[model samples]
Target: MRAIVVTEHGGPEVLHPSEVPAPEPGAGQLAVEVAAAGVNYIDTYHRTGRYPTKPPFTPGVEVAGTVVAVGPGVTGFAAGDLVATADAVGGYAERALVNADRAIAVPAGADLRLAAAALLQGMTAHYLTHSTHPVLPGETVLVHAAAGGMGLLLTQLVKLRGGRVIGTVSTPEKERLAREAGADEVLGYDGFAEAVRDLTGGEGVAAVYDGVGRTTFDGSLAALRRRGVLALYGAASGPVDPVDPMRLAGAGGVYLTRPSLAHYTVTREELAERAGDVLRWVASGELKLHIGRTYPLADARTAHEDLEGRRTTGKLLLIP
Candidate 1:
């Protein structure tokens, strides 16, 4: 088997495909024959030492594939069931041993690649819209990185709930993608705070989902109405500098939260429920995955480069 190994963290170049033995499932786990692996910004963080991992680890977090083997005591699943999974390690390869509890059955008609793409970021979007602050009918939302993978899915979901979406992206092409995904207004990433203010008639928004991190955090906070939620989920531009708690109060009396999918879906039931909602939405075409790019298993580093360098949009995947 060939898998991506990060023996030591540094840059995208540190991710390389290497030959290794295939893994077997442990108790309550499933050994999946990896068909597709989801790429995420956190992968870049881990590789670049922004989020450290011990040496000699495979880099992917999500997988979509067939269950080839089930471990002891696992129930309600078996070989040949198509499934998608998240939060486990060792998915950037031909196989992964995923906890059965974390696996969600992929809808029969969902494209395997699309299902894989939807697992991590899609669910992140789900909990963001549904749990974190819960976008409401007629409320205005501002989504950073609005053309990116999670951004687009979240925009559509917010719209589905009748919220008005204002998304921020770096280019005209991305602006088009955000608008297509139901963002009522799309602003250039450059000077986005002013754009957001103008789009909202200077009253600001009900919430701001700031995935772009440091580059937009303060501006996003400024672009909110009193009591608006500032959900900072990712740091694509860079990590936010140390923030004073007073900043939240100073900026429109806002509420600030830094959420990750892991914290939101802490239990097996929570994971399944959120994942099920996303899968159902995808299956019904109410939510669409924008699978921007894919790389063969061996090209994992290039995939990371493209994702981190802003050369692609939506979810990036590795075809294992």
Candidate 2:
């Protein structure tokens, strides 16, 4: 099997592609022949040592593939089953080991590439709008990086729930994309909080879904209404500094939460519900996924460079 190994935490160059022994499924695990692996910000975090990961580890976590082997104690799966998982063990490889509980069935006729792309970001968007704060009808919310993969999904989900979306983008093209995704208002990063306030008639939005951390943290808090929530989900730019609790109080008694998909889908039931909803929506055409780019497995480093440079939009995938 071939995989990208992070021998050390550093730049994209550290993602060394090499041949390795094929992984075998452990108890309650499945060995999958990977079709596609999703490249995410969390992967970059792992490569950069921002997240606590040991060296000499594979760098991917989300994948869609066909099961080639099933381990002891696993049930409801077989060698030929098509499955997808957001908690894959060493997914950036030709083969991966996925816990049976975390692996979800890819509906018959669904594209494996699309399924891989939708798993992590799709579930993250679902939890942000449906659980973190629950975007209610008649409510207005702000979504940063509104042209990115998660942003587009979050915008559409909020609209589906009848909430108005105020999206922040970095370019005019991105603004158009955000608007097309059902964002009621689109503004550039500059002065976006003020624009949100103005659009909401000085009341601000009900919540702000912020994936672009550090630079947008303060603005996200400012764009919220009194008691509105700020769901900080990612640190694309960089991690934010330690915040004082009083800041939340001063910001109109606002609520703040930093959530990850792992926490949201900690149980098998929760994982199935969220992943099922996302896949069903995509299959039914109710949810649209923009797969911005696809790279060969060997080009994992290039994928990371493009993603970190913000040179691409939507979900990026590595074909194995």
The local distance difference test score of each candidate is 0.88, 0.93
Stretches of model 1 off by over 4 angstroms after superposition: 108-110
lDDT of each residue in 1-320, candidate 1, tens digit only? 98999899888899988999999988999999988999998888888888878888898888999999999999989999998987766989999888888888875656889888887888898889999989889999999888999889889989999999988888889988998999898888778778778887888999888888888887888899888899999999899998898988888678988999899889989998988888888888999888888889999989988988988888898997
Looking at model 1, the pairs that clash are 149-314
TM-score for all predictions? 0.97, 0.99
Candidate 2 residue spans exceeding 4 A from truth: none
User: Candidate 2: worst 10 consecutive residues by lDDT?
Assistant: 102-111
In each prediction, how many residue pairs overlap at the backbone (N, C-alpha, C within less than 3 A)? 1, 0
Tell me how far candidate 2 lies from the true structure as C-alpha RMSD in angstroms: 0.8
